[model samples]
Target: MSQTATILVIDDEPQIRKFLRISLSSQGYKVLEAATAGEGLSQAALNKPDLVVLDLGLPDMDGQQALAELREWSQVPVLVLSVRAGEADKVLALDGGANDYVTKPFGIQEFLARLRALLRQAPAGEAAPALVQVGQLRIDLALRRVSLGDAEVALTRKEYAVLAQLARHPGRVITQQQLLKDVWGPSHVDDSHYLRIVVAHLRQKLADEPAAPRYIVTEAGVGYRLMG
Candidate 1:
């Protein structure tokens, strides 16, 4: 799969990026580079790479923050590579959104093995469809972009999270607990109010009305469903 896979490397060190580019390219994997967390995120959104190699220390923003933001709309496999070998740092990165973690000064063979393992877990065949359209609403899940007909819709991270979940399963009731756990994490599963507020905000931005809903329909104390 390395022959067709695309990997995005997000690290501030020019030497590190160059090394990874060479190593990955040697294995026939297409590589994309970004020098900062912000740039890395833009590259991830634009390229929709098969896997991401992230570094925890970044110049503009923490890599953990970048991981959290990327998780808002993408489930692409992420392997965090950082110099921080502390157990706490590893735990934080894994819990935040990383699929795997490698400390700096690691062996190239081991890194490549881990990379291959992550790629094997993704769906075979071609990459999953990145776009989902329902009526006038169009969602580019890979880019974390949403649009309603001709105009693009700007959504907060949480807003996009909820909408993306709902959009993935149109015409099906997504339980409130499920949405809470996914969008807000497990600790907030019982926090129905949080989910409600986000849904309301999502609806407002999508120009959907609760009384006469077109896109989202409330299920009367159960949950919400996206009407495609």
Candidate 2:
């Protein structure tokens, strides 16, 4: 079934679109291409590809706007491709709706690995696990609620998603890019500030000390790990 999944590639650069089309096709995925955001949206609505590789800078529309539009109508996984390395850009894209973000000049192997991970986690078939517990925090995915000890904690939608991803993989060092992509969607992977802000918020809510956290530990220039 995985072998038959269709991946839509949206980019203004012919080179990128061609490269991804060939690479994805070589990996046994059916590939579709679009040169503009408008075209991408049209194809997405019609074909309903299993996943989308969207470039942030498009001719017809900015990638972020495209992502927002897509999210309104579809739950299809989106992986954002951009040259912008700013943390703010990453956070904005993720906050908007991208599932993952990859910077320009990315290593092919790493990109493929990230794509595989996102696809593996995409909502499909069975119902996702709803209840996740880490230390004193209890997350009820179904109810979109979190509680630490005797107090209820509040989180933004993206915050909950980030925590959920970490809680799902306790003790794992989830990369900043991965967390950004997973929580904010793909477009925000490069926006590390979103991750920082959200992590800070999570630590404030769940950790014994926000400065020196027990549950969420930063690896410093690497990523974050949720200690079990």
- Model 1, 49-142: lDDT tens digits are 9999999899998989889878766788999999999999999999988999999999999999999999988755443335678789998865
Reference-based TM-score of each model: 0.78, 0.55
Compared with the true structure, the alpha-carbon lDDT of candidate 2 equals 0.80
Per-candidate clashes, comma-separated: 0, 11
The global C-alpha lDDT for each of the candidates, from Candidate 1 onward, is: 0.88, 0.80
Per-residue C-alpha lDDT of model 2 across residues 104-188, encoded as one tens digit per residue: 9888889888888888878875333345667777766434468988788888877777876776567888899998876677998
* Best candidate according to lDDT: 1
Model 1's alpha-carbon lDDT is 0.88
